[model samples]
Target: MIDISRTLNADTPTWPEDEPFSYDLTASIADTGSVNIGQFTTSCHTATHIDAPFHFNNSGLTVDQLPIDLYVGRVLVVDVTTKQRITPEDLALIDLQGVRRVILKTDTWPNGAPFPTEIPELDARLGSFFHEHGVELVGVDLPSVDPLDSKTLDTHHAFEANDIHILEGVTLDGVEAGLYHLSALPLKLEGADGSPVRAILQEI
Candidate 1:
């Protein structure tokens, strides 16, 4: 099995001006005379995470309400490294027939690197393209599918309009392009717009 999730640490990069991850011992063995207790606080969008529709739309489903099957199953890892803009035409050569999940390996965000100021742009049309191909889930190695400074989130809304789910901030370094069994379920966060996920892949 290969772990594709990013490690959550105090140094883990977060969105601009957003909350960074933090962890500390709330009660240690010395204080409790028992087991150590720790507590952590982090933005739901930090690290490897799945974004429920509620992330962009207040009326959309929450993280806990998402279907479990959407995150598990055969997934195709398409290597589109170095491409500044990803569009449907770039994926024309791939055999997407019957593929329900696709993980784009951008190789842009190296593990433990500082938060990127810029990354590849995902064309809004790919949303309809994926939906037409019957894809239910789309994952990316970058922090987000849309541009960092984007306020409209055109690509995000497009995917949601097409009923496609989004998984972001995955660490795809060293992972090759091919098909694998993916398991990247979100935390059962009631009413939350997003949740951190432990994304993993296994040879099929």
Candidate 2:
């Protein structure tokens, strides 16, 4: 299995002004004379995470309410590295066939790099295009599908309109483009807008 999840630690870059990831040992093995107990605080969107519809839509489903099947299944890793903007036209030449999930390998966010100010743009129109091709989930190796400063998340809303779910911040560097079995289940946090995921891919 190829692990796509980003390591959650103090160095993991988060959205500017958002909560940074931090872990503290609440009970050390020496102090407790037993197992080490630790606690962490982080933004749900930090690292590799799945954004529930509730993240962009107040009336939409929360992380716990999302369908389990959407997070685990056959997925396609399409390499769209170097593209400034990803639109339906850009994906038109690719064969989606029976694909239900697609993770775009943008190679924009390097591992261990600081949070980026600019990233490739994901067009909202691809939402319907993917829907037409039977895609139910879309993943990206970036923080958000929309621009970081966006107040109106058009792509998020469009994806929701087409029944497509979002998975973000996956590390896809050096991973070739191909078919794989994905397992990126979210924590069942009721009423939460999003949840960090331990995303992984296995060769099919």
Candidate 3:
């Protein structure tokens, strides 16, 4: 299995002004005379995570309400690293038939580096396009599907409106474009907007 999730740490890049991930030992073995206990605090959107519809829409589903099968299944990984603005036309040749989950390998954010100021933009049109193709989930190597500074979050809303889910901040640096069995289940955070996932891909 190839782990595609980014490491959560103080250094893990998060959205601007969002909370950075931090971990601390709540009870040390020396003090408790038992196992060490640790605790962590982080923004739901930090690192590799899936955004529940509630992340944007007030009436949409929360993290716990999402379907588990959407995050685990046969996924098609397509390399669109050459385009800054990815659109349906760019993916015209790739066959997405029967693929419920698709991961775009932009390779723009390689090496699990700091948050990028700019990255490729996934056109909002993909929301309907993917829906038409029966795609349930869309994953991206970059932090978001829309532009980083986007205020309207058009792509995000489009996906949500079309019943397509979003998985962001994935690390697909060395993974090639092909079919793989993906397992990127999110935590059962009740009423939360999102949750970090331990995303991984196994060769099939």
Candidate 3, 15: how far from true, in Å?
A: 1.2
The alpha-carbon deviation from the true structure for residue 58 of candidate 2, after best TM-score superposition, in angstroms, is: 1.1
TM-score per candidate: 0.98, 0.97, 0.98
**lDDT of each model, Cα atoms only?**
0.95, 0.95, 0.93
Error of 2 at 16 (Å): 0.9
Q: Tell me the spans in candidate 1 whose CA falls farther than 4 Å from its real position.
A: none
Candidate 3, TM-score vs. the true structure? 0.98
Please give the distance, in angstroms, between residue 158's alpha carbon in candidate 3 and its true position after superposition: 0.8
The residue-by-residue lDDT of candidate 2 on 67-109, one tens digit each, is 9999899999999996989999999999999999999999999
- Weakest 10 consecutive residues, lDDT, candidate 1? 10-19
Off by over 4 Å in 3: none
For model 2, what is the error of residue 55's alpha carbon versus the real structure, in angstroms, after optimal superposition? 0.8
